[model samples]
Target: MSKTVGAEGWTVVHQARQKHYDDRYYGQFLGTRKDGRWIVGRMWSGRSMDDGFHDGGWDWSKRFAEPSSTDAADAALKSYVEMSHETFVWNRVFEQRVGEAIDAYWAGPEVPGAPRLSAGWCRTPDGLPGGSTVGLPFHEAKYRLLQYLRSTESTARADLSPRTFNLHDAVELIRQANGPFRFQHGYNAYWLADDAS
Candidate 1:
C-alpha cells in the first residue's frame, strides 16, 4: 500500500486489498461534484495506463460502483462539492494574493492563540555568509522564478523576496547550463540581478 498527503493534510490511503479494484500503482485522486453527484476518481494523464502518471482525469464509473440510493448519492455529492470548493478557493487565493493570504492566515484573529513564528538568519550547508537552510541555492531559485514569471505574468517578479527567490535563479542557471536561452521572455525581464526583482 502507498499513501499520499495533500498540501492541506488530507491523507489518501491506497491499499491493494483487492486486485479487481486496484491498479498496479496508485495515482493521484480528486474528490469532485458533478451532475448533482459526489465522486472520487483517479487522475489520468493523456498517455495509456502503462505510461507514467500525471495528475488529471476523474472518471467516476471506473472507480466506484453506482450509488445504492439517491440519499447516499446526494450526501456523497455534497462532500465532493465542499472539498472541491475548498481546493479551488485555496489555489485561487494563493495565486492572486499570496502575501496577503499568508499574513492573514498566520496573523489573523482566527489564529489568536497560535504562537508566533521565529525569525533569524542561519548558515547554509556550504556556510555562505547570508545563507539559510530553508531555500535552494540562490542561482537555482532565481532561475525557477524566472521560468514561472515567463509562463505566468510579467508582474510576477514583483513578488520576489529572498525567501521565495530561489525558483527564478534556478531557471536561469538551468538555461545557462544547458545552452543558449530558448525562452520567449528576455533574461532581463526577470530582473534577476536586482534584490527586489
Candidate 2:
C-alpha cells in the first residue's frame, strides 16, 4: 500500500552500535511470522558470522511510526536513501566519495592538474576556506573539526579514531563543522590531509 519510505510496511529495522567496527561485524536481522502474519522486525546488511549475529544483546529491536503527511513520508525516504546508499555503490572507490570525486581531491603532491577543495567549497560564514587548493580525507576532517569545535565552543574533544571512515563521511563532517578542513602544512604535506583533515 506504500511505495515511499526506504522500508515499507511490515518491515524490519536493525541498528548495531558497538565500541568499534573492526570485529567480525556479527549482527542479525530477525523477522517474525506469527499470528498468521510475517512481520519484518529487524534488518542488517554487513559482515556477520556464518551462524548469525548479535549486538551484545543491546544492538537490536523494532518499531513502527506512521507518517501523518506525504511530505513526512518523502522526508523519511530521503533519510533512507542517505543511509543505505552504500548498498548500491558501483565500486569500492566510489563508495568512499566525499564531494565531487575522490580523485578531484588528493592527499599528496599536486602537479597543478587535480581539482582540489578550494574557496568555492565552503560558503557559510562559519565555513570559510583558506586561500589554497588542497582537499582532505575523512579522518583529517575529524581531527580538524574537533579542533574547531573545541576552539569555538569550549567543548571537550572526544577520543575518536580519525581513520575509521571513508572520504565522503569526512567531507560531510567538515561541512557540518562550518568549514575548517583546510590544510595548514606546506604543499609537500598534502599526504597529511587524511590523517589530519
Top candidate (TM-score): 1
- lDDT tens digits by residue: candidate 1, 1-197: 11333343322222111112333332333222222222343433223343322332232322222442223332443344344333232234333332222122212132233222211122223332322122323334333443344344443343443344343343334333322222222222222222222
Reference-based lDDT, residue 138, model 1:
38
The digit string of per-residue lDDT tens for model 2 on 1-197 reads 11111332322222221222455333323221111122212234345433232332223333323332222222333343343333232234322222112112212123243223322122233444422233544334333343332222212112232433323333334434332334221111111132223
- For each of the candidates, the C-alpha root-mean-square deviation to the true structure, in angstroms, is 18.6, 16.0
Question: Evaluated with lDDT, which candidate comes out highest?
Answer: 1
lDDT of 2 at 135: 57
CA displacement after TM-score superposition, residue 12 of candidate 2 (Å): 3.7
Backbone clashes in candidate 2 total 7
| Prediction 2 TM-score vs. true | 0.19
